[model samples]
Target: MDAVPGRKAPMASGSAPDLMYCQPCAEDGNKILPDAFCPVCKEFLCSTCARVHRNQKITKSHALQDKTSMPSSFCAESEDEKFSVTCQHHSKEFIKYYCPRHDALLCGDCVIENENHRSCMVEKILQVAKRYQEGEEYISLKTGLGQMVRDIENYILYIQVRMKSVDEENLTNINEFRKFRNEINQYLDKRENELLAEIDQTKRTSKTFLNELKTKYTNIKSATEKLQSDLHAHEANSNQLLIVGKRAIKELEDLQTALEKVSMSKDVSRYTFDRDPATERLLASETAIGRLKEGESTTTLGQQQQKQEKKQQEQRKQQESKQQQHKPTQAPSHKVNFQSSVDLSQSQFSRQPDIPMKTSGDTRNCFLSSVACLSGNRILLADYNNQSVKLILRPTWCCPRLLCQVDHGTCVNCPVTGQPSL
Candidate 1:
C-alpha cells in the first residue's frame, strides 16, 4: 500500500540493471558512489578518476563540498529560514540581531530570554538599525569615491614625478654631453702633446744628421783644394829638376809616384765624405715622420663596439617610447543644444561642467563638477558659499545652463522655500 498506488512493483535497491556503471571498475556509477563528486557537474567519481581530474590546475576549485549536499544561500551565522532578517543597527547580516552598544549579535531566543537588553527601547533600536543600513550604503559610496580620488591623485602625482624625473634626466644628459666634450678636448690635447714631442725629436735628429753631413762635406772640399795646390807647385819647381841629374832622375820618378798616391788618397777621402750613410738613414726617418703626421683612419674595436651598442640602445629606447604612448583616451565632449526638443512635454537636466585647459604644448588639464536633478525640471545651482540659489532657466527651455557664484557669507544647504533661497 505504500507503493505508488499499487500500480507497479517497486524495484529492488541493488537490482536496477539500467543504472550507469563505471567502465573501468564495473561498479554502479550512481549508487556505488565515488569518494567525492566532480565540482563542475557534481557527478560522483572514483578515486582514480578524481586523480585524473585533479591534474587540471584551473579546475581545482570545482572540488566536491564536504557533506555532498548543496550549500545554502543564507548567511552562515543565521538559523532563520523565513522573514530574511538583517541587523538594522550593525550594518552587516541577513538574519542576525546585533546590539550597537555592545557591537554583537543575538539569536531569536536570546532576544526573548537575555536580560542584558531589557531596558533598551526597541523602536529606537530599530531606528538605529535603519540608520546603520543607510550608513553602510553611504560608506560604500564614500569608499568608492575615496578610492577614485586617491587613484586620480596618485595618477597626477605619478605624472608630475615622471615629468620631473624626465627633466632631471635630460639635464643630467646635457651635463654628460658637456663632460664628453671636455673629455674629447682633453684627449685631443694629450694626443697633440705626444705628437708635438715626437715631431720635435724627429726635427732634432734631422738637424743633427744634416749638420754632421755638412761638416764632412766642408772638410772634404778643403782637403781636395790643398792637395791640388801641392801637386801644381811640384810640377812648376825649377830647383827640383837641378837635383834630378842622373841620380836625381830616379828621385824625381819616386816623388812623382808618391804624389800620385797622395792624389788617390784625397779622391778616396772626398768620396767617403760625399757618400754619408747617416744622411740616407735620416731621409728615411723624415719619411716615417711624415707618415706619422697623417694618422691611421681605420676604426678601432672600441669605436665599432660603441656604434653597435648605440644602435641596440636606440632600438630599446624606441620600444620604450612606444609603450609610453599607450594610455587611456580622453572623455568625449558633450554640447548642449536647446533647439532639438520642441515636442517633449517634460524636460529634465542636471547642471554639470567639465572644463579643459591646455597646460602646455603637449599637455592639458581638466576640471569636473557634480550634477543633481531635482523636482519641477527647474535647475538649482548649489553654491557652497553664497546663501542664495539662482534659477538657471525657465521651464520652457529644454536644456539650460546653470551658473553659481560663491559669496563669503552663505550656507549651501539653506532652505529652498522662497526667492533667492535654494
Candidate 2:
C-alpha cells in the first residue's frame, strides 16, 4: 500500500500509529510496518525492504537490527530525535562507513557523492575503529612518538650540560686573563720605579763629581790670585821678587799638569733606556708589556780604571822585555847553593847569576816570543824567528834536553792565548 500525502498512514489492526514505518517503502508512497532498523542508513526497514537491502552489493555490509529491539530514540517520529552524531560533509546524514584508502569515516551521501570510493574498499566505521585499537600500525605510531620524545629530552640534556661547561670555561679564562694582566701591571710598575731610581742615582753621582771638580778649580783659582798678588807686592824687593816668581812658575806648571790629566769624554758617560728586542716583537699581538733596560755607552769608572791599569801593566812588560833584549849576555861566575826551603821575605841578593844551558841548534838570533813552565820540570819556548815552539826537559840547569819541536806561522809571534784545561 502507498502512503498518502499529508495523511496519516493506517496501521495494522491493534497497532499504534506512532510505530515506525519502512523508510524505502514510504518513499515509494507505500505504508508498511517496519521489521528491521538499518543503523548505517539510520532508517527503519520493512521485512521485504530489509531482504532487498541485504541482497544489494552496496548496502549488503550495513548492519541492521530488529525494529522491536531498536532504540526508541532511533525510531522517533521527528528527524531531529534520531541519532545525535552526523556526518561532517553531509550535515543531514550520519557517519556510517569508513574508507580505508582515505582513512576517513563517510556517510551514505558521501559514498555516493565521491567517485573515489567507487573502487576503494570501505567498511563499517565501527569495525574499522575496533581494528585500529589493536592494530600494529597504531601501536608502532605510539612507540615512535615515545622514542621521539625521549630523543628530544636527551638532546635538551646534552645542550644543558654543554652550556654549563662553556660558561665555566669562560669564567676560568676571564679569571686567568685578569691575573695575567695584574702580574704584568705589577712587574711594569716595579720596573718603572727601578729605572727611575737608576736615573736619579746617575744624575746625583754626575752632579757630585761636577761639584768636586768645581770646588777644586775654585781653590786653584784662589791660589793663582794669591800668587799674582804676592808677585805684585814683591816687585820692589829683588829677593822676594825672585822667590814669588819661582813659586808662581811652579804653580802654573802644576795647573797645566792638572788640566792635562782631566779628560771630558762624552762617549764614556752616555745613558739610555731601551726595550728588549724580543719582548718588543712579542708585544705586537699580545697584551703583555715589553721589559725596559738601562743601557750605557761605556763601562763604569772603576771598570775603566781597571782596564787602564791592565793596559799600562802590559806596556810596562813590553818595555822591560825590550830592555832585557838589548842587554848583553854573561856566563855564570858562581854556583848557587840549592835550598830545601827559603824565606822569601829575608831572601836578598845583589846580583843573580844566570845559569847557561848548552843548546843543540843555533840560539844567538832566535827571538823567543813567549816561555811557559810545565809539569815535571819541562819548559816550552816559542821561537818567533824560527817559527817553532820547543819543549825542553831540564833535568839539570846545565844539561837541558830538547824533547820536541812544533813549527807554526804568525801564531809564534803572537801573544800566548790560554786554552781550557785538559
Indicate which candidate wins on TM-score.
2
Total backbone clashes of candidate 2, pairs 3 or more residues apart or in separate chains: 3
How do the residues 1-422 of candidate 1 rate in per-residue lDDT, one tens digit apiece?
11111012435788643332222233332334344454444344457656665775544556654335533211111134432656454334343455655555654445566687655433323324535644666689889999999878877776787679769977977787778768867976997798778767767776776676566656555655655555555666656534434444454566566556545542212111243586468556855212213334434445657988999999999888667645443342243322321212233334535322223332322222333334566555443333334434334323222212222222221122211222
lDDT of 2 at 292: 28
RMSD of each: 30.2, 31.6
Candidate 1 lDDT score relative to the true structure: 0.47
Ten contiguous residues with the weakest lDDT in model 2: 413-422
lDDT of 2: 0.65
**By summed lDDT, which 10 consecutive residues of candidate 1 come out lowest?**
410-419
Superposed model 1: Cα runs more than 4 Å off: 1-142, 238-422
lDDT of 2 at 345: 41
- For model 2 the local lDDT of residue 253 reads 89
Please write out the lDDT profile of model 2 over residues 55-116, one tens digit for every residue. Answer: 98767887888856765434223323433589988898877788988887888888899999
